[model samples]
Target: MPGKPPLLFDEAFLRKLERLSLVARRARSGYFRGERRSTRRGQSVEFADYRNYVRGDDLRALDWNIYARLERPFIKLFEEEVDQTVHILFDASASMDWPPHPAEHHKWNYARRLAAALGYIALANHDRLTVAALSGDAFTPWGPERRRRSIHRLLAFLSDLPAAGQTRLVPALTRYAGQTKRPGLLFLLSDLLTPEDLRPGLSTLQYRGHEIALLHLLSPDEVTPSLAGDLQLQDVETAARQDITINATVKTLYRQKFDAWQGEIEGFCRQRGIHYTLLTTDRPFETLVLHFLRQRGFVR
Candidate 1:
């Protein structure tokens, strides 16, 4: 697929796009200005309730008219509310730097475009956004503020992310789960080719009350290994290689294994009520964002 326009991450797109909101099917009751019904109601202009204001409260909301007649300094404070935070966890690993062959696209490039488009969409809609690269050690994951003004910060954070090293999804995810105190939407984008099982990692985040959404990016070659005869398949990240003669039976077995792996992942996500979608690098990112994702309710 052709690469996305660099302007996809521009501020103009965000300003025009913020009107569109993703209707989260699962209950996510934090805050947002959108008219969508929330599971938890709080202090918004929509009017939830009123309580006595404490010290250091905004005095403008004080019921001056009430005080003039009733002789009481009753202040009206709007309920605490805002948009839900959209936490985007992108995988920047060496495996994602896999080269494109023939009609296939680069994995990292595809991921980057998707990340940028999604971030823009979220920011445009007045939703809070946190874009992080969880491929490093338990260090700080940086990104723009949830507001629309932080467009440059979000772009820089994504552009500077390096695609290198082996991925330890469990450690990275567990660390994020520990640090994040608020419950919100979480999207994990990765090829998921780590040596370790990814289930434990995903489960950790899910247990933290996050609406887990997994975007599995796979290359055409990885899904269907077209190698035949004597060949050496080298691990792109580890630099390890295994030499084997590819016969029809071997090819069949590999296909079975690949299918089984995909099935296992799909089953795991379904069982946990997590949203899972697979995207091949060869497909257009716009199609994924505007069509496939909308069908999945990530956009509307």
Candidate 2:
């Protein structure tokens, strides 16, 4: 029998999470009442501004004190608090299941933990949360659920997700961007090992008005391989093989190419107002969530 999956969060960690909430840079209209302040004025207790009273304005909103002092009726506008929709697009492509060995700091496992932590924060704050797994042509999604009660369901979905198939990022992202009518904060967790150009998909999401944060996951071996001598590397997704001789010069070239690739992605994200963070599997997921994310203004 398969051993039980490790718990994603402990009770103490969950208690700490309850104090934090996902931050949205721009106000968004939400379906249900929540902690986020909306752009629209409503009946919430927080005072927004005062506007000249119009003919059809609600009599209850009239500031009687202002009317008495200035002899002009002003309507009090209160800020509306509403829930935000949070989307976590997790890449469960074959590249994420790197380093093969179970004891290693698996990229897939690390991504899942990050997703779970973010989902928990959203749920705790009563924001609608959706967790989607993207692999090949399939985009499996789970919930637009709100409240702490849904955390278990979110964890379960992520725990059962398997990393397989090629990374079809563009298609998956385009489809998701087209289908989601309401835009909010979107977090993408992926290894991003695909050869496809990601600009089109990212642009589509941005055009649809979603605030995107890309968490680029990588393993230590991928960043700095220790293999030496001539060997054949088989692509896990396509089963394609490549012959290469690992030498000091080759290692230097590989590092340069890798750095250039990462710099390109970061530059693209910077130009498009998308938040990009490179995460290594060896780093503690808790530190990424509680410290790095907070420092980056993602959570508070």
Candidate 3:
């Protein structure tokens, strides 16, 4: 890991991301006050709507202009700017760590940077953030923190994390959902190359009230393989081995299946209102956070 680049965004980059924030699709009601606007009435400067004043209501929120005109007290309900929780679930399974090739360092490394950028944005804007690495059954969680001061902790946790073992996506997600006390925006970053179907996991998160975003990552080599004939392939997770011959026909067929699988994942997420994006390890991480994610309305 000596030649590996640093794990964090630079100060200038951090400053830029500080101005951006994750978008809350709906008015979220959270326990603490934050930068995100909510449907519930609160003491924020932006006003939302008004309703008839009831007993025990605060006198400060009562609109004197409406009362003088109609003789009925109307309470002003301003849009409440409250904290929105952002959970980044990163996949640290063995398959994510491809080796013996240049792309071996790419997938998990890119994911870490992506998580760091978003986590910085969340913290800078005072949104609660929890980053959990999905290694197996019970994963490791770093935080449910909101302050920018915790950025160091986030970076450290992500940097030192190791990728290993087989991760059944469905089970990992189910466990994560069960432990999540509050849900806002959940980003699941993974290759999703596991044997388990991703549908059940996605559905579980959706049912638990988490706004899901799937960031599907694949190495460039994995996408467009240039391997020759007589290859011994081994599964990174299961250690299953198979000997096969790679011909022109094999490459063509593999490409077709790969494209189809990507399409299928996209369609599944779309039907369920989950945000999905396919990214290659070679793509600039900055482009993903600054352009691709913005285009999807993930960050603004």
Candidate 4:
């Protein structure tokens, strides 16, 4: 009987971030001529490097004096400048709908809110934004615009995404891994209920020069299930079932596995210099925007 709750941030929330720009640990391509230096540089008054001139090269870029004296053709090569794209990959899987009995909020609803909030942040900064739903190896592109006005489009995209299918994170990510030639930022929001190996897919993105960030979302009940007796642990997405008894040792083992899994994910992100954060849907959107994400350099 429950439906998607209204998105958290309104006009007021967006107004507070109108003057800000997207921030990253390392510089990335972007618009508006900001202070953060991008990896892709051009003839923007910042000197990059020099290379030997080749056929069809710009004659003006040639070091005339070097060619005249040393009889060598050389040209200056600045970083290739381009706008940064913010790719939001939301896992639209059935498992995201699973919640404890009588829960007020669903995992998918929480994930949508966070995605919308992040979309607003990126839109306010004039960064190119795209929202995609991962169903197996398919990427359903949502918002592919580059203006503040596209925020509404993004919201609509997230609002209507059906909570269907199983999550195949590695396959979904692998599909677009080498496709995007432009280096940008990838924001993956999910409960991570996938059997797919995320490392290989993530590594592919890194190889293409993308700065990846993971936003792991979960519900309070998922962290602490209420089953105090024998229970059937069903895979929400895959419909696979596991029967088990709930006892002190079982609960302890479950919690340990959860902690270890999260720690391993954190360590993986750290090793690859990817920004990572874990959030329960119960938290406020503003808290994530103003605190957790800010600490990770999302908006500055």
* TM-score of candidate 2 relative to the true fold: 0.79
> Judged by lDDT against the true structure, how good is candidate 2?
0.75
Whole-model lDDT, candidate 1?
0.67
Winning model by TM-score: 2
Better of 1 and 4 by TM-score: 4
- Model 4 stretches with alpha carbons more than 4 Å out: 6-82, 100-105
Query: Could you give the candidate ranking by TM-score, starting with the highest?
Result: 2, 3, 4, 1
lDDT of 3 by residue, 155-218 (tens): 8787788778877788889999998899788889999997678999999999998888799988
Angstrom error of the Cα, residue 242, model 1: value is 1.1
Candidate lDDT scores, in order, read: 0.67, 0.75, 0.75, 0.68
- Tens digits of per-residue lDDT, candidate 4, 157-271, equal 7777777777688877878775555557888888886766688988988888777888888887678766788888777666689989999898889899999988998999999
Error of 3 at 23 (Å): 12
lDDT of 4: 0.68
Can you tell me which runs of candidate 3 are displaced by over 4 Å? 1-80, 99-105
The TM-score obtained by model 3 is: 0.77
Model 1 lowest lDDT segment of ten: 24-33
Residue 16 shift from truth in candidate 2, angstroms? 6.1
lDDT by residue (tens digit), candidate 1, 1-300: 223336545666454334333332111232222223344544345432223444555586678887798776655532233345778888877888777332337787667667766776666444567777867545347653555566667767666666777778889989888888765777789998886888888888888878887999998878877778998888867889999999989988999998898889999999999888887877865556666555754553
Off by over 4 Å in 1: 1-81, 100-104, 136-140
